[model samples]
Target: MSTASDYLSRLISFDSVSRNSNEPVSDCVAAWLQELNFEVERTTYVDPRGVRKCNLLARRDPIAAQEQTLASGTGGLAYFCHTDTVTADRWTGPGGNPFHAVFENGRIYGRGACDMKGSLAAMLDAAQSISLADQMRPLWIVCTADEEVGFEGAQYLVDHSAAFRDLASLDPVSIIGEPTRLSVIHAHKGIVGMRIRSQGKAAHSSTDMGINANVAMVPMLQTLLEIDEQCRTDETLRNDAFDPPTLTWNFGVSDEMKTVNIVPDHCTAWASMRTMPGVDGREIVERVRRRAEELGLSFDLYSGGDPMHTDRDAPFVKELCELAEPYIGANEPHAVCYATDGCVLGELNRRIVCGPGGIAQAHTSDEFIEIEQLENGVRFYQDAIRHWCC
Candidate 1:
């Protein structure tokens, strides 16, 4: 098998779901990079549920070896990919088993195949063609954990990784390989999720002593709808760069009472929206929070991050766009609705979300990456490595 296919098959075999320990995947990646003589560093942390998550960073820095610092968008090139896959309980791909990766009809079927083990495989295969002696600058490969969850791995690395800090110093071009279909991405939306709760005394449904907290969410839901509509119509609140050009707001409330006869005391509703780069996410959030407080509801922010925006006209973007011409052919750097680790690694000056495969295939019951895209991805990454590292 080709190195990319071999590495991809091996990677997909590991059930590195976000909720489980990623040590096995990390171990294999570390070993593979080490075989290429790259300096490997690991940052390990336990998630809230005590799952052992590990982030791996490997780099080949010829200048640093001689007591100097060098960096790549290809300063030195750093390819960031997440090791965690979403829960594959719904997987019904050609393999029948999510972890066994089935190859047929010029496609590889499995969990994380397109949503990004394929991209990681491409990076691994591409790196093999470039040795340390072939680089005047540096090359970086970062396999992070918990990206599918909340970018916790990238955030943890930002807070605890020394090597990451050094990479930031170069202001290197950072590419988050996030199923962008190999297009150069200069911007994307961010996530804003929160839970709102209301408290009331419980009593019999027929008795007045019981308070139905569910009634409190009526007005709050109204406020959210208003914001959603305004976002949809208000040019000032929307960015034309996005497809929907709105926050894409969503929320729901679940009834906790087992029986309708008993008065329900607890009610919780969650509303999540996206943040645009040029828009003020704070004001939008404040509007919802204010309504929740006025209605005597408890509001808590669980997930929130600013949209990533890198100048499309930047030299680094231009170079990538030019290089991607063979694939996308003069298509301007695009934007996506999804969020990525770039939300956490915002400090890196030139950041883009570019990778193989389509988001259309991700998180589906049957996830796969086309063999042609995978092979082209290998060539793309290899050329990028040469551009930034050599």
Candidate 2:
């Protein structure tokens, strides 16, 4: 039997970064499930970059697939995890390779250790430890690709895959294994990523003939800042459940001219907004566009994920909290500030975010998961399986 730690080490070695193909890691997971007598369906799709990404959906019993009817009572349980991790170029461990898992000081250090191949390993171990014959409902494990880059793999599964269609039809109680330090998460902010481009005529800096796109962006940026301030001060957008209790915006990236002597003809700025549950992300985008237009600049809203909030009093959530409380100590269903693939999956079924490690450790130079936490995560998943599937 492979322990969670053993499975984590193998998963970490895959280097399944978001910009790269997740086929290798997905293949490993599929094979492992197959070995457990699961009927695996590999859904392959070509990403926008023409890279082939694979999403794996596995069920323990093959006959379950033919059962067209959804489970009526105590429906199936599905564990969802993303196979891709963000890029890590500055690893601080001994091997200096982000893909190489290193155990040190009671922690497993790797790129995806915290957010969240750790949870993936725990789910695998817990599933394998349980006897399928005792399960009252089908157990499904889904591994999606490109979660780090706008959840493209999840989007593909929801839009195109037949396996996901069947699972959605069943209305399974779902768990999205994002690292929450084993606490239950019922609410989280959404993200809206936008790219605004300012175009102007290029000329020598010494001459006033150039429109200077960089200069043109100043008023537009100020407009965004004002809008952000309004969002921060608005009580309507506040959700007291979340920390800070208001929408947050950041202008993180900019593309502009390289040389000092040339007046920039084109300038692009990338910004993201984190919105509360009831806030309208599309309205926010339109507001930004309106502001840009008023400032005489061209703008485009590119990508975003919706805010997610499962009722804390939901039966499944309460059951999960009860099941996880023993291992995690007073498991409270709280809200997080960051986004998850749950933003998409929550639309399909009743879902919660619960797993090992902390968001603080995710995507850091020294990403790691505490050994004890990893073990407890396995226990949590096992308890969930017993509660929901048995």
Off by over 4 Å in 1: 63-65, 68-74, 203-209
The models' CA-based lDDT, in order, is 0.87, 0.84
lDDT of 1 by residue, 1-390 (tens): 248889999999999989899999999999999888789999999999988899998887774444444322326788899999999997778858999989999999989999999999998999898767777777889999998888899999989999998888877778888888889999998888889898888898988998888888789888877877887787787888998888888888875878978888888888888888887467878888889889989999875567899998999999998888887677789888999998888888789999999999999889999999998899899889888777
Candidate 2: the clashing residue pairs are none
In model 2, which regions exceed 4 Å deviation? Answer: 62-74, 252-255
**TM-score of model 2 (CA atoms):** 0.94
Per-residue lDDT of candidate 2, residues 191-279 (tens digit)? 88888888888889899998777777887778777777877887877788889787777774364567888888888877788877877
- Give the worst 10-residue stretch by lDDT in candidate 1: 65-74
Best by lDDT: 1
